[model samples]
Every structure is written in structure tokens, then in C-alpha cells.
Target: MIGQQAIRDWLFINGKIEKAVHILSSLHSPDDKVFVNRKEKDGSTSKVPCPLALKDYNSNMNFVDNFDRLKKDNQCDRKSHKWYMRLFFHFIDCCVVNSFIIYEELDTDGKKLTNKNFRREVYTGLLSRKLVDVQSPSILKKRTKSTTEISNHKPHVSKHLRLTESKHQPTQISSRRCAMCSTKKKPQRTK
Candidate 1:
């Protein structure tokens, strides 16, 4: 208590800091302190005082730390020269890890599959599925031709009259491939 007024609830670490830090915690009120390393103005490390909550959070972020460990060590994402490929593989790895966590929670049986085993099982299941012909990647068109046919009105001398009168309609021969059919990325398809 300072005279008649008393500060409550929030911890402030402002002394000898380039930037002031304020932390409010329901668990820890102000006046809680633990010895922590701090860099002096002379650029030397020192064990200065720190809040118990901040120290605890640094030492005990178990789930996030565990995920970083798993991704770095166990994930099968490969290094690629293509920036997009690297991002894609990393995204796939994150999905696998997240799904494994969900599977662990949803499982009622006492038996639990290890992360490696879970990944392997998923890989095999994906490979075993038969892809449909229409969903296959990279279907080459037999020939490229403009499918639009103009109306049977002959062009008169006036350019404006021709544009206003003429109507071009798409002639349906075979079902044209979907927009993504010819691209060499993921899936190709045709009817």
C-alpha cells in the first residue's frame, strides 16, 4: 500500500528495460517475483527479478512446444527448391499432426497409435483408394478450336450495326473439360 492508494492485480516490469512490460494474471497478483536473466545497458546477462506467471508460461507451454518438436523431428515434409512446394508440404504435415491429435481425443479404446504409425496408416489408406478417370490429372484436349458460332446474319457495311445485330452462341459437341483439367498440379478430369 502506497499511503492511502494500493495497486492491485497487474505486474509491471519497467526498471532497466528498453520497453516496459505489463502482465495481468488471475493466478498471480503483483508482488510475485522470480530471479530471471536480464541484459544490462552494458550488454551483460544478469539474473534479475521476473514475474512467476511469465516464468511458468515459458517453462511449461507443453502442447505448443510438443507440436514444434514433432514437426521438426518426425514430420515427413521434404525440402524443395519451389517455394510453393515447401509451403504445400508443410501445410500437409500440419494437417496430419492436427488430425492425429483429434484422433487421440476421439478414441474410446485404451489402445493408442503412435504418431508414426498413425501417419503410415493414413498414407496407406490414401494410396489404396482408386481415383476416378474424370478426377485424373492432365487430360489433353483432342484439338483446340473456338466453340462459339456466330448467328447467320451477314455483316453489312456498318460496323456498329454488325456488332449490335450479331449474336455468338456456344456450339455443344462434346462436354468440354473443366477449367483445371489440363493443368499439371493435382487432379485432371474429363467426361
Candidate 2:
């Protein structure tokens, strides 16, 4: 492949001047141009100016092939009938690969992480981060209750016991997100 740094050179093949070439380096960038043979609609061989990257791609594709191989080695692909979900998993795999590339660049220690290990570390880190609740307090104030409590069938409180207890203070109640409801679905409209 013709790299971005490769010097400009010309080659004559079949009497057409072919531009740059690549041998020892990776594929060339999309900046420069090269003349290559193209079949005309009239069944005549024509010289076409092709992008160096395109020419390099036509010759040998190592970058994309290597990246695909790396991603496939430890992919986050999930079996899903939904096209969007499959795309989402593939997106996740791409993100992992991107992050791994950045990590490789920033890493200075002698010890380096493999792509699989990097993905594992990333998964563990995501699982380990503290999750924050974004639900509003108004929605959280009302929570699920037992049928007996909801029916208001509590035993009558003794006047003396109530007087002895601090009625002015509010009691703290534990609340959590419901499995069957959210801010959007199953909104709590009734007390």
C-alpha cells in the first residue's frame, strides 16, 4: 500500500502512466492520485486517475481487515431479530475497539493490554461504576403498598399512644423504581 509519506513515483503498464505504488508501507491516504486501467463502456481500455488510497485498497486492504479480525476475536455481537439491536451491538463493538486504540496510544508502561483483556476491563469498569437515579422526587413520593394498607383498614390508634409518639415528625419510607412502571409508562395518577 502507498502510505501518506511515500514519495511520488510513476510506472508504465500497458502504455498507461500509473502513479504511486506501495510495497513496504501501509495503504496510502486518499489525497494523491494514480492512473490505472479502466474498461470503457465501448469495450476499450481507458486510463483512469484513481485515488492513492483507492488504488492501495484495490491492491491490499490490511487496516480494515486487521481491525475486523480484532473485533471478531472478542466482539459484543448479540443474536437479535431486530435490525436496530444488532446494529447497536455492533456499535458497541466499534466503541470498544476505538477505546482500545486510544488506550494503546496513551499507554506508556511496558506492560500492554490485549484487545480481549482491554474489552474485559472496560466491561468490568462499566459494571463497577456507581449508577445514579434520575427520577424526580414527586414521582418517587408515592410508592407501592400492601392491599391491607391501601384499604385504610389500620387499627384505630390509641389517643394516649398517639400523644406519646411524636406526631409532628414525618416517618422515612424506603422507595425504589418499580419493575412494571417508569416516568413514561404506568404513571401514578391515583393515591
Candidate 3:
């Protein structure tokens, strides 16, 4: 993680010169350097360079730290996602941060809204636009109907039911009338 700062000294490993290091200059500032330190096993220390130069730790965070803070603040740092879902969540967070920056930059009148406020406004806008729709009464009813339909239809295998007897296992044959055809009575009827 070597930053764009020009190092006057060579990189040393265990009190020996390893190589001459120089970070590529950035477009914003050529002189800025994000510096880090690594403690060697011999009790000595070495400078660790970062690729992206950032403001002082007291003033502003680096890209990595800022992203971490955003995830923490937004409560989007969930550990339950699969690999692809994790990538998607990271992309969403990046978009959110990008949107916040754009919003701040576009405000000509200089309206100062905190990150939380901006996020809340974004969420409200999404809800209003139906982009993030919640489970409404009508939708809930439809979902319940679909669930009942699914549950009424028995599966081929009932793994959860540990029936020791072979005769106890569920079978398609039943002495009931088909729900779809009320007048028809068949040995194997499905509701």
C-alpha cells in the first residue's frame, strides 16, 4: 500500500536495504503520503506505505477506514450474506456514499445535512417511489394464500417426519374428493 509520496530513504528489511521505493503521484496532490508503520521482530520499526494518500487521521479517514465507518454507521455490515450477496452489499454501500457526495456537491445553497439525515431521505424517497416496497395488507394476504396453496400440496418426501414403518409414509392415494373437482371422487386426489 505505497502512497504517492516520494521517499528519500530506501526501504530496509532487518537493518538491510531491500529496495528503493517510490509511490506514484496522484492527480489531486503529488506530495501527500498516507504513512503507516510496521514493527519488526528485532524491536525495530519500518514505514508502511499506502497507495492512496489521505488527510491526517484526526481530520479525515482513508478510503478503507471511511468505507468501514459507512458500513458501521448504516448498519449494513451483516455477516449472513453469501459471496455474491456480499459483493452486492458492498456495491450498494459504494453507491450510497457516492450519492451522498454528489448530493453535498450539488447543493448550491450550501444546505448542510448529516449522513444519517441524507440516508433517511434516500430511504424515504425509495419507499415513496415503491423501489423499496414494504409488505402491505394486500400483499400479505396474497402471500398467505400462496403459502396455503403450497402447504396443502404434499411433497414427494417427508424427510422431517421420521416414520419407522414403511406403511406410515405419506402416499398420494387418499379417500377424499378433489378440491378442484368437487363432484369427482377418486382414490388419488390432490387438494
Best by TM-score: 1
Candidate 3: which stretches are off by over 4 Å? Answer: 1-64, 128-191
Over the stretch 1-191, how does candidate 3's per-residue lDDT look in tens digits? 22233334322111112444432322334434465666788999998663333324224646668767765687444575488877777777778877887787798887788888787777666553322333355665665334323346443322332343222344344754433454445445455
Give lDDT tens digits, candidate 2, residues 21-112.
Answer: 44332344335678999887799998877666566656666867867888899997889999999999999998999888788889988679
Model-by-model lDDT, in order? 0.61, 0.62, 0.53
Which has the better TM-score: candidate 1, or candidate 3? Answer: 1
lDDT value, residue 150 of candidate 2: 42
Stretches of model 1 off by over 4 angstroms after superposition: 1-48, 130-191
lDDT of model 1 at position 126: 62
The TM-score values for the models, in the order shown, are: 0.42, 0.40, 0.36
| Per-structure clash totals for the candidates | 2, 1, 5
| Angstrom error at residue 172, model 1 | 60
Candidate 2 RMSD to the correct structure:
18.5
Lowest summed lDDT over 10 consecutive residues: which window, candidate 3? Answer: 9-18
